[model samples]
Target: MAQETAQQAPTTAHTAPARALLPLILPAALVGVVASLVFVGVSTAAEQLQHVLWGPLPDALGVGRYSVLWMFVMLVATGFAVGLVVWKVPGHAGPDPATLGLDARTMPPVVLPGLVLATGLMLAGGPSLGPENPIIAVNVALAVWLGRRFLPRTPGALWPVLAEAATIGALFGTPLAAALVVSEALAGRPMRGRLWDNVFAPLTAGAFGAMTTTLVFHPTFDLGLPTLGHPHWQDLVAALVIASASAVLGMCAVYAFPYIHKAFLGLRHPMLMLPAGGLVLGALAALGGHLTLFKGLSEVGVLARDPEGWSAGQFATMAVVKLAALLVAASCGFRGGRIFPSVFVGTALGLCAHALVPAVQPALGVATGVLGILLAITRQGWVSLFTAAVLVASPAVLALLCIASLPAWLLVTGRPQMQLRDDGTPIR
Candidate 1:
């Protein structure tokens, strides 16, 4: 009997992690569904607002769609509206968006309304940022609040992980993306139990979140580039050059991010800072034309569909203008995330490279450009690599992109990230 007891103890130890997954399944699925629903609801509201603000309202005013003057006025108005919320609302829109991301400190439920309003206003007003950061914050806070009421035994930290997984999966339209981003985050941290134990719940949540978003919105991605059948040795060289140059450009922005945030914060009031920032962004949008406005998702498709149609100079102008928009929106009190804008800038850089050289394939150029820029901006190799691969939608170039990332990663590893200090100061 004593011998049997010893054997049973080892068996139980071996199966503990697997058994843990079974009980977590329901909670994980619920988190995924709830998180995705919140994201969809907010995004839908923003899209409707966008259509009205940029469409029917303009028609009522007898102006053309996205007219420069209307856009300028609307953007300024958005700034004031969001600033009012930040100044008057319960949570001050959670935190300054310039200093936040998926992995930031978790906020309370009281912050949700402010975050939603700020995100909606910024999205509707055509800020060069995405709903990622603000949306994630909202979902995370909601998940924690719900978990406390319904899942009394669950760890508080697990809710953040689940919320991040669900939101990232929904945003990227893939569970793999959430996995890559989270694993990259957890890679070097101290390990206490089996790694799969930590990964199982998040993966389950992310998968459901991705499926829910896909069924609801069906976001589009069409590059119109020729299929990349196979990679050549020359492709490697081109990728290296393009990616390196993009890394340098991204580093310039990264180093400058803190100073820009400080300057805007120095305004000392959202009332003053955001409207002024909006004016600057409006001027830039006017200079770069309509294509450089917005979060750059649909605009990226526009750029990718006709890489050869634009002159090198045109592409350069778009990249520069979008980069400036990203800086301003982040620093100037607008609520949004940096990833989408960085992707747009990267795509423009790749298109510019193809325009200049004509020898590099558009897919190779775009993928490598995105990889370098995202790596520098996020400082996460797995997320950057996955995003670049997914953007071009070409599996053939994956190997070359993987190789290209190494050099880019080396360039950005020790650099300052785009996040800010808690006191609104730049982290050096």
Candidate 2:
């Protein structure tokens, strides 16, 4: 009887950790799914609005769908509209996006709706931004609110981790993306238990989020390049050169980011700053054409599909225009993220490289370009590497990309990053 009781005690002890982890895993998984749904809903609404304004409305009015004049007018109108919301909204739309990044402070539940509305407007009308930061902020706020309401015993810090992981998973349509990003983020932090233990709840949340997003959206970023047979010596050299050049180019923007942000802040009023920003964006759009507008995710596809069709001059112009648009959108209090626009800029630059030198593989050129630009912009090596490799949709080139990333990292390390100041001001 003594031996049997001892065995039973050990069995119960073994089960205790799993039982305790249930609360963490379950709530995080729930947050992941809910966050994915929220993102899908928000993006869908923006798409519909975009179709109405840029598609049906123009057709109904007997104007060309790609009319540059109309595009300028619409963008200016979008800027004014978003500015008005920021001026009068209950939460001031939860902070300027140019001053925010993936690691922003969690906002209150009351502010979530305002942020969502501003993001939708920015996305739907026209802005060189993506849904990443605002949507992540929304999920973080929602997750925290839900946790307080239902899982009072849960750790507070875990909420942001799970929220970030879930949203990243949803955004990229893969749990691996979130895992890599989280691992990189949490690598140096002191923690108890195994590293995987820290990652368990967040990875679980990310898996659910990715799966849910895939089911609903079925998004793809494949450029449909012919299968890369093997990495050639020339490919390595070319990738290094391309990535290094792109990094150098990106640094120019990084240096300019703070100054532009400060200039916009000097205006000190949404009425003045946002609308003026809108007009600047309008002029850029008129100059760069339709492909240079928007948050730039879909534009990458458009560029990739027909790289050969465009001349080197055209590609260079697009790259420059997109970079400028990203700067304006970010500095002008736009509600969006930097990743997608940065990716677009990189793609344009890569296409230019390929056009100038046909010997370079499109996949290789694009991957390295993206790697360099993302590194320079975000200052995160793993995220930059992952984004570059994933954009190519070819795992075979990852080894070459790893090699290319070394030079790229060297260029971007210690450079000014695209994050805002802690006191709700521009980082100078």
Candidate 3:
């Protein structure tokens, strides 16, 4: 009796009123809140472990926390741990993280445990990657698994969209980013409804997701740079130069990605490849200092706080090292995403631009710099715009970014994406 009733819930969430989006509202909002809860749980656990690994453990041993030598030790150890999970766990931690992006697909319920373990370790272990990719994967997997078990009548396809939107909203602390990304994904696909109607469910999920995450985390993206009241003609010129150059630099990384991934994969085992990548990352951390070590959100904050402290050369080196580390981390079997570390690279380069040309407003420098690098790497124009604008927290920066993004987009449009391809499909 319960089994039959459970098997049949609401009507297959397929039919909707032509004018109103009502059926998806409650389920999607609930999914969004629950997704944010999952994110907060995983991140909190990772942070606790991170503190232990980088703090008391080092102090007890009388070594400098996050020191050059300690970084080498911890990073190698972390690689070993993640490698073990990838090798021994089911689904091999749900595909090589190097091959994934915002479009990471859902996985089996069996794969979720190992995926969470691997991603959590990557986050705590200081692999220059972020939680965005794997968290999305995790949420999507869970949403599908649980949604089917409970809400069997919901259309199968809607689960992925709701999950992805919710995760993006939770990760960025704003539903707007999710809305833009979903809009981009929706375009060019044959669909039944109007754009706004189609987006209605995702927007609801994103709103709830963002709201829950913000209530829990109090996250903010602004950098506290001196605000620009109005855009200057020179600001446009400076933004153009910075954005274009940053895009080229990002392209260089994109070009190098396949070679790097091939080199690491050539090792033929997660154990050997990941540890070797760790050694290289240790060397990079030494050159770029501790700020280049982690996924880079807090480190970026530090950089923004003391923008004038580092020399231009120093900032440039940090940018290069972080970019290199991002490449290595992504290529070598680590379970994480590239966006946060890429943002750090852009931030450092933007600061370098400001250091070189004091005439450029620091906000404009960083915003355009981010715009260019994000465009080159993510190939998501709306993400590049949203993330960069959030950095400056200025409406005026948007105009400059709009102009600067034109050239940056041109440089990156025909280039290879940062991920390697597999038989025309993105590797899963």
Candidate 4:
């Protein structure tokens, strides 16, 4: 009877953990699905707005007349958004959309909604931020809330890990990336043999979320490549060189971006800061002849679609102007993701490279350069490469891009470690 009772005790203890996980897992998955759907809806809305507003706004703004006013408007809008976030949200806002690198576990939940709303505004209002990071942030927050509500007795760690993975997977449209992000976030933590089991629920949840995203909305960019001309050894070398250069630039961006953000934060009054940022943005927009006003995806598309429209000098000028505008807007407390601006910079750099190295195929050079910048700045190597390849419809170019991105990656390594609190604590 003693031995039987002992065995029963062990069984009871073992069953408890499994049973505890059940409630968390199921609710987490449902939350993930809902979050993904929300992301799809938001992304779709943003894209449609971009299309509708792009042409009309520019024409109405009348290039020179609107530039200053637009800048001021952007600043005011951004300040308002930031104020809302700071006042209402718990974590002061969501994740830094620019410095994202699989660190979701440490994220706070209260800032999710504000981040989402702010990001949507940024995107629709013509800021350079992307929708992906905000989407992931909201999803993770929602998952945590759902898990806590449903499984109050479960371990806290499980929900975050699962939620982050699911959200990342759904955002990236790839389970592999999501899994990798989760692994990175959980790095240094001691999970024992339970790590794999814990991830299982998240991975399943992520898969469900991704499927829902796919069914509800189509990706804005085509993620495919077609056969293209063979890449030469010289092309490969050029790509490598370009990739290295991009990485270096990326490192600079990562390090400088925070400071830029800080400058905007330092502004005591939103009324002054918003108008100032908008004015600067407008002046910069004038340099690009109105091309620099919006989120820059359309501008990138224009360059990609017609590589010859702008001369080398024009491309270089535009790239510099866009970068300056992005810096100013971001620094002035403009709410948005940095992804589109980075892409704009990459595209301009690629165009410049094509002009400098006439031996390289223009399309290939542009594609490679863009990919390299994406890899370096975002640290999302595969996604960047895929985006570049798909935009050009060329596998050979992608191969070259992959080779070139190495140096950029090497140069930019360890540059984005800077972290600052609202009161300037310098956390990282």
Candidate 2 local distance difference test against the native = 0.86
lDDT preference between candidates 3 and 4, better one = 3
Those runs of model 2 whose alpha carbons end farther than 4 Å from true positions after fitting are 1-17, 422-428
lDDT of 4 by residue, 1-428 (tens): 99888878742212236665566567657756886787777777766765545446656767433455555565356546655654556665554433443344345655766666666666766554556555665666666676678777766666656666666666656565565555554555765445555466677677777777777764444322224478788878877776666656665655676777667656765555555666666566666756665667666777766666788899888877877776665556544545567677777777788777767676666676677667655666556766676566665676677667666666655555323355543334
User: Could you tell me the lDDT of residue 328 within candidate 1?
Assistant: 87
The candidate 3 region of ten consecutive residues with least summed lDDT is 419-428
For all candidates in order, the CA lDDT equals 0.85, 0.86, 0.89, 0.62
Judged by lDDT, which candidate is best?
A: 3
Clashes of 3: 0
Query: Residues 116-171, candidate 2, lDDT per residue (tens digit)?
Result: 99999999998899999999999999998888888888888888889999999999
How do all models score by TM-score? 0.94, 0.94, 0.94, 0.76
- Candidate 1 CA-lDDT value: 0.85
RMSD of each: 3.7, 5.3, 7.6, 6.6
Expressed as tens digits, the lDDT of each residue in 323-359 for candidate 1 is 8889888888898988899999999999899989988
